[model samples]
Target: MSAAQDPGTPPRPHAMLIAQITDPHIGLQPGPATGPLDPTGSLRRALAHVRALQPAVDVLLLTGDLADSGRPQDYAEIATLLADTLPTPADGGPRVLAVPGNHDRRAPARQALAAAMPVAPDAPGDCVCLHVEHGGLHLIGLDTVVPGAAHGALAAEQLAWLQRHLTACAGAPVLIFMHHPPLISGMAAMDACGLLQGRAELGRIVAAHGGVQAIAAGHLHRAIVGQLGGAPVVVAPSSSHQLTLDLRPDAPLALRFEPPMIGLYRWTAADGIACHFSYVEAFGPSHPI
Candidate 1:
């Protein structure tokens, strides 16, 4: 009999649940005139949605752009917001992890988020990199912030670090999270600021390791997917606003009021990994069909 029909067969292991909310761009004084009135409010709603999920999320990943201008006060405010909205790990809340974006100041971001989302002890002084193990899965967060530039890149040292980690986790599944996507998005302006350096080397590393299940990122303010070294790259939508879908060669950057969304990633040894984009807003109660 098939496993489904055989009552004696053990059930499959529970899947690991991960929720990603990115590009909130919080602390915009006079928030964007188009999207949600307050960026923090949007982030709060997204976090609440994650908290309310039936099977609580195992990890909450703040991909990047947590602050609009990467100010110290902004990060302070973000820390407060996180403390107020999410319960402590001791209280059964998911582990929080973050990486800096182009809009973030590495020093301030590291200082503020450290208390809540600590990085690996071996992480370099120049950037924030995280490594965590949960339910036999390896989660790695790579910092792609380039300080004064809008584009992103990984330093050689950081790349070497990543290679060492991937090698150590040779046969285990790994999920990578970062700020800027390595692949080019058709959006002209956005593509110009995409991961300009280390793209090829990163791809080679992932291909050689062959254990990376998926790579998740933010920075485009929209959901995008592409392939890098045979693994799917899932870019999460912004929690505050989305960029207009303009693929023209010279299309200017623009914002849209599309519903804010988050990325839900589920992984299991039996089914591999799957990503789903979920809207953060509450759309009335469901009625039986």
Candidate 2:
């Protein structure tokens, strides 16, 4: 019989819950022909859904593309929304953590969000890298934005810093969160703009350390699963809109009105980690069978 089936086995400990919301694209404005895309409304719904979850999440992880344009006003709007929607730390709200995407201005984002999620002081330049611990789990956020470009990369200095942190973890479970995914998604247009540099080095580092339980990222605007150095990589869907799912090599970039979603990660000592996607829309109440 399995451990779960055996009465002698103790029950697993409570898992740490993390809600991942990504690619809100807060300032995006579509042309007249496409009609209005309510990015802000979608984000509000996402936050409401997270706020209603029972037992509550331990952390709220934003995986980038927070703003459509790198504008200080957009970042400020995001901060205002967070303040209005979520409860304060004193009121039992989960801690917020974030990294920057290509659409973000590093300095503006840092200024707006620093009070909630502070970046590491040792972070080189304007990168928003972070390292924090909760309940023995190590959370690492990497800033993968390439200024004025859609593609992403990791600098050599950042890689060295990451290596030092992973080395210090000493076999503790680690979860790395970033904006761009290192693996290809078969969406040709999106893959063309995916992580362009240092992915191999990142894989090497994860493989060498053997402590990374998983890597969570957001860029593809769809829920995707892949592997890097034998560790699982999960790509979260956008909270505002989604990319067209065409995989043809010549397929052009396109957007669709697919249901917006958020990712939830459950991590326990007995069961490493598992990811689930929750739609942002409400479907009324459920009835018993």
The clash count for each model shown is 0, 0
Clashes of 2: 0
| Positional deviation of residue 158's Cα in model 1 after best superposition, in angstroms | 1.4
Tell me the tens digit of each residue's lDDT in model 1 across 199-274: 9999999999898999999999898999899899999999988899999999989888788899999988778999
lDDT of 2 by residue, 205-233 (tens): 99998879889999999999999987999
RMSD of each: 6.3, 6.3
Q: lDDT per model, in order?
A: 0.84, 0.85
lDDT of 2: 0.85
Give the TM-score comparing model 2 with the true structure, all chains together: 0.93
What's the TM-score of each model vs. the native? Answer: 0.92, 0.93
As a TM-score, model 1 comes out at 0.92
| Candidate 1: C-alpha RMSD after superposition | 6.3
